[model samples]
Target: MNDQPAADTARRLTTQEAARALGVKPATVYAYVSRGRLTNRRDPVGRGSTFDAGEVEALALRSRREAAAPAGELSVRTSLTLIEDDRYWFRGVDAVELASRYPYEEVAEWLWTGGPRPGARFTAPPEALAAARRAVAALPEHSGPVDRLRVAVAAAAVTDPLRFDLSEEAVLGSARSLVPTLAGALLELGAPAGDGAPVARELWSRLTAADPEPRALEVLDLALGLLTDHDLAASTLAVRVAASARAHPYAAVSAGLGALEGPLHGAAGRLAHRMLVEVLERGGAAPVVAEYLRAGRAVPGLGHRLYRGEDPRAGALFGRLADLPQAAPALAAARDVTAVMARHGLHANVDLALAVLTVSCGMRAEAGETVFAVARTAGWIAHALEEYQERPLRMRPSGQYQGPRPPQPLP
Candidate 1:
């Protein structure tokens, strides 16, 4: 066998390739995309973005990675889709369509069950869910809601007798119990727990905007459905990696949660909201792009790993902007930045839309990541369940490093 690898098949890249070739990140390539300065076309296979080979070469001449990067073998293939590009499809249904049209709860059912809602009504055991809900409800009102939610999950796993079962029914029930309960806990802590209501509904009410339009549930369902799962993101990958080891659901969720807490995964939504305001407050659209460029930061909501040019999800959510009149300030900023930035080569993603959603709904600025945590828990659970049943190996690899051969002295 030859030691030298064959030429790479990834000759043509989309924005990311060009960006990589440009000695910058993909988001910078997004700047060029938004500017329409480079030549690009659709990825014929999945209808995502594709980069031009010649353009990539041109930019690669100046790239830092041109010589240092070496080609390698493609090793593992798994059922998970990490680094998902373009559309988020679950069981072959487009996630963008779902999030735009369905209620959040309905989306949860679909994600947890991996099947459309069958019967008109169904019931899960209330005991675990109620306990989980009560636990979350006790968090301090001013505490980080997401952290409190994670703690409640850990507590519930410790308290519950059935946490180790890992059966399909058990996992599903746990999901139904956990998500609703987490949301409820936040609401109760924010307002008053068990004041006079069923906990789940109270949380949902708090999560949603006060003046929802007639189609609010439909919109939430669709959004939740859209976000519930995508190809394996970093958070999803962490969940799947944990699950691949037959880790407990709580453990898997914890791994995923840790990943999501990073700025790369969960901070985008809040950043978009804040950035839009900063742009508007400074000097409208004129200074927004320049400020980001000077700071060497990408416009938060405008670029994506999967969407080559315009993010389809962004377009879908943009369609809903008309429904929210109260978000004018943020909207104006979003519109101005989007308009100006597109001239350079970027399109908004779910983060941008969600930022708009948060602003329009009168939701607190801090709630963006919390909402994401709530929505993404379903996927984490599903992946965990899949890992519990499917993978043969748990984990075995360990590190070997140079060290003193002598054993450590006892204290």
Candidate 2:
């Protein structure tokens, strides 16, 4: 006999009805189908697809549960960063202001320690760089930069006999070396590595072969600093989870990199990059934006949940990009996309701004993701450092089991 619920006999809902039940756009309903989150069948009586009402309700419930916090939600105290009033701060100082004024290395140093450490520089140890390069080089040719970075971190860890040391100084030491090692491991585009150069400069060499314009380089450095940290982001939380398990700093960073693989996270910029490129090719944003909606996909790089207005990082970058003559077309494209999205009450986010930078710089679409991974490494280490001081396994959260309660009969 079938074990199916009685609701299976209920009438099915059309795609529009399903989207309404789920409180999402009709396109998003299709996106759910594409992502395997929901299933649909073509309606014999109509052109549109139909979803089982029971299945749609179940999926909607699941989405709600995932989006809402669980009972007894976990919270952690941090001195690293704060977000409030549509602005963010690092250790109580205005983050955007700090990023605007200092170089990437200095801002990173300030995050890791209280001091700005003006003129700070990070150089990867030769042995660590060599090991990271060897491991990264062994990855499949199809591997993305973040994939290579994950391998590079693990390889660099193997070379550090003292990787297990959880002390702040040792973790800081590991962080300084690891960031650059990750940069050095990527297959360089064309720009030569500069010895003792800022992290932004070193990363530029890897992301593209285009000769660096001074103003463009400055914008890149600012981007790095702006992206250094923003409270407990998904990847930063992953780093803390690993650190709470007493994993080595390298391992914690590896955990963060793993979280970065998700499309909703690190890969968002790449999506925005491709979208902007398409806008340029099509000579307008209207058709491109409509196509995204038509495809049941959200226009990426728009509407950050955290900020009700514009994303401060995007604003900052846009202000600087306006100064670069070469970035004019791409920058205009970004503005056009935002204007189109504005009709839907969405605004540009940092991913959109980063896309403009990558497009104008002649870098590949994935270049923004690479920049994010490198810059956020410092923030991850900072979070790891904070977690190291907390009680062991403090990050573990209890599950609220909603599955079968007791055994009734054997299957």
Q: Pick the candidate with the highest lDDT.
A: 2
**Residue range with the least summed lDDT across 10 consecutive positions in model 1:** 72-81
Model 2, runs deviating above 4 Å: 1-72, 407-411
Task: TM-score each candidate.
Answer: 0.69, 0.82
lDDT of 1 by residue, 288-346 (tens): 77878889988888888677766776677667665656656676778788888877778
lDDT of 2 by residue, 1-411 (tens): 135455753467998899889887786677567546688877766799888888899977865654464546777768889889889999889999999999988899999987769788899999999999899888899999889999999999999898998877898888889888888888888767677877777888888898878899999999999999989889999999999899999999999999999877899999999999999999999999999999999998999888999999999999999999989999999999999888799999999999999999999999999999999999999998877765467676678888897976788
Model 1 lDDT vs. the true structure? Answer: 0.63
Model 1 clash number: 20
Candidate 1 TM-score over all chains jointly = 0.69
Task: Report, for every candidate in turn, its global Cα lDDT versus the true structure.
Answer: 0.63, 0.88
CA shift of 311, model 1, Å: 2.5
Candidate 1's error at 21, in angstroms?
47
